[model samples]
Target: MAKNTTKNTEGQAPKGVRKPPATRKTAAQKKAEAEAKLKQQQLETGEGDNTPTDTPEQPNNEPTGETAEKEVTAGASESSAGQEGKTTETDKIKSDANPPVGNSTIEDLSDDEFDKGKRDGVSDDVEDQELMEGQMKLEDDGSTKIGDNPMLTDTKDKEEVQPFVRKTKIEKTSSNVSIKSLFKEWKKDQALRAKYRQEAEEAIKSGLPAPEFEDETTLRFDLAIQRNETWTDYQKSDLIHTVLYGYYLQPVLVEDSNDGKKWFIDGKQRLTTLMTFIEGQWALSKKTKPVYGYKIAGFKFNDLPSEMQDEIMDETITLVRIKNMTVAERDEMFVKQNSGTPLSKIELIRAMHSELSEQIDIELSSLKFFKEDLELTKKAKDKFIDVELILQIAMLIEEGKDRIKGLGADNYKEYVLRLKETEQIFSDEMIEKISNISNYLTLAFEDYEMDEVKKALKKVNVPIIFWTAITAMDDNLQPKLFGDFIRSFLISGYSVESAYGKSSQAGSSKKENVLIRLDEMSAALSQFIDMIRNASSIEEGVEQFNKHLADVNGVDREEGEDGERESA
Candidate 1:
């Protein structure tokens, strides 16, 4: 029992078979695991990078696919959180009693990492070159020609004044910095950008050192403020109130100049507000609620307590300093930043692609109907509704109704692209034909100068009636009596109802609704035009036109019968 201690030498575990010391992890794998752990921690803490989740896909920059997935997933989640935060805050403050300070053009500057890429509100892929190209087409030479209107000044000269280059190669100014420290230092510099803000504020308080207009930013401000018509006093007050409440003031975008001053690319209005208020030129707005227990609305900056003034001074904001980009690039960026504003789709298109927009604008302006007749509301003007109407008609004539109808409101990206495609399809010959059609419409609506015709035209905002009729006409088949055609189709009660029905469909840009509306109008109007062209007399033409319209209306009512109730 005492003697089992001695084992045979062969019984010992074989050499090199001691289970290899648990296979120590390689340094590279350990490093990878550590990095992954750090990334997970960052994600959980919400301190990860905030670059746009929708940046164009490119070759993976990370060494491994797993890491790339982690970055993308984290970035997307972060963006969603920021978006939710903005929505919640916006809903809480958006009350009927408080007049809107400004359009949603303002961004909340608190989110330091938020990047408003092209087409901020529309969609993520808006910045794609192909997508942007679909917004509009520039002239072959990348310059626009003014239409043949003596009243319209040559815009080529204005184009010449723009910077030859649109963007600078970008470089980072800093990783991240608080607005309190950055502005405090930035203000002390005596360069043009800094000097102007300082002098403008001092001048407001002391009535000395009049502001100078040297740079584009200051020049634009001078043009707006000196004219005194661009923004009303109430608008100015409202903007001030919004900024004070920390709701939605977009960060000022700037680029550094050689003289150590930054050039303002956007946010002119917000900057002007801050400068004006600091100098005591404006008081707190009457409607603004005080922040941090400081209810000082209507109190001049000088009248506020020292601590309150300090609190305002120390308030931090995000300032984006982009180093290299062209002027055109900057303008587009400005458009994207302001996309949250209540701008119309066409307006956004104009900003996204200017050369083509200007070309379209000039051509539309040249039409006598637009120049001397069409009466657009101020809201319509802001939304570029007139431009959209003209573009829609022109595109429809060029590409047929199906293509136009397919471009729905929700498919804004596609709609813009199709409109841009019009430039390609509308050759010189096509343009001339369209122009001729416009001229014919002008003559048909000859009494457009009269208040009654003007009223009727305004009431029928859709231009499709003219488009449908004009497209359906034979090459040389002029109506036997153009005046009769106009009176019956445009100024008449039935014509008004048909056109206005399409206009009400503006609530949605859905493909189905758009197609239905356009299809109905085109069918009825084309038949009317053919009847007018073939009839021996105006009375006969009117009879046929009325009968066709009645039949078409009856058909439309019965067509969507799936939803109709059956009589008991």
Candidate 2:
């Protein structure tokens, strides 16, 4: 039952090709994936003879849909049996003894796209449609209707009919309406409502059974009235006015309203849905005061609960109006909205670079960055890790200049991200590429007598120190590169080596290269302010690091790398 352990030359992984950590799914997950694949195959073979009968022991189809239904039943039993025949763990181990390395497959080295609105990797069960479902409002009778927001556009079965395409986050497309699209959509909805209302009134007056009208309603409004915390009566009244306009202008929108071009800065779908329900008088249901009468989307002036309902209703239809601004304005607008949440200096700096006026924001973010480092170390959370900062500092020390060449900023962000994703994917040899960065940093800071490096290390708040150390190893980098860098970082203030392994400090986990990397990090950051100023992107800044590295390589080459650079 055992196969010989030999590497397949053809299956060899492409050089520098790192594999994603292959996660083994649970039985339920595997079953779902298998079923999905089978369904897809069935679709492809519906009218053809391509039904897979490669295994005589498996179900054979009759080429009829009825036959297919029966075959599907039979296939379940046969497939389960086939699954049982898969290689055992021991056998798998023997066969995989010489598996392929990510040693031919090419991957596009695209920048990581940040999805800011939601947390990363929300469960698949949490569909975008869920947001729409909550987009409900009471019909005059207190029933629920689905929210009509463009974000929920794909939720309807009809929208799914077309073959789908997955687009990258940064991909440029005409219809990827920026937050600016809110006003335009609102105006469109308003016009549509007015036209329908006029036709209905005419039909009613003409003694017709029913007037032509759109069956559903959507959430769309261009006003910044919805915030999670509290909604004022004035804001509520403003919202009512917007909805009232929709009802009055039923068949003819006053196109002259100057506020009709705004988009969502916040509460995007929620605001729009509230107004839509009110305008269309759709059925909306909730826990209490569940029905906001579809007769008109008015809030009861005397009732507190009614006021709350109005707030919810307003939220479902509110949007922030946008102006025709350059890309810089948009970036600033984004940053301002995110300001409520604590952000790293690197993140702020990256945004600031797009605007000459906002360049000073980097200092504020830097202070935030320092605080984040402290917090990350205390909590050992990944978010607190200052990966970009460490890389910026490290590359500067090693390259002598402010930037890395080729891929740009010394591949700082890329390196950090890869380490995070494939912490276990790359081999020890491969890991050295990053580990050396840590060592070089340590040696670079050793020459400086500052307490700041020690403080940063002692605080042990950020994950950056650990990664910097990990990357400073050979993966051929020595301790010298970052030791001076670390020292310099602190000379502007902190010392780290004073309590090398002292038990009294906040972070006492002193692995051999840990302190060394911390020092390197300190040194890199201290001396690399200029590198930061020159950085256009995370990669570009690392190029400045190449200049720092040139000096480091020269020193290490001449003095010969000390035994201090050896792996623990």
Runs in model 2 lying further than 4 Å from the true structure: 1-307, 314-320, 333-347, 353-568
lDDT of 2 by residue, 154-197 (tens): 66657446687864222211222222243345556677888888
Candidate 1 error regions (>4 Å): 1-168, 171-235, 241-251, 254-265, 268-323, 326-332, 339-344, 365-368, 418-436, 449-463, 472-487, 490-568
Report lDDT per candidate: 0.50, 0.39
- Please, what is the TM-score per model? 0.42, 0.22
The sequence of per-residue lDDT tens digits that candidate 1 reaches over residues 277-335 is: 77677776676567667686678877878865665566655567776665456556667
lDDT of 2 at 398: 43
- Give the range of the ten consecutive residues with the poorest summed lDDT in model 2: 104-113
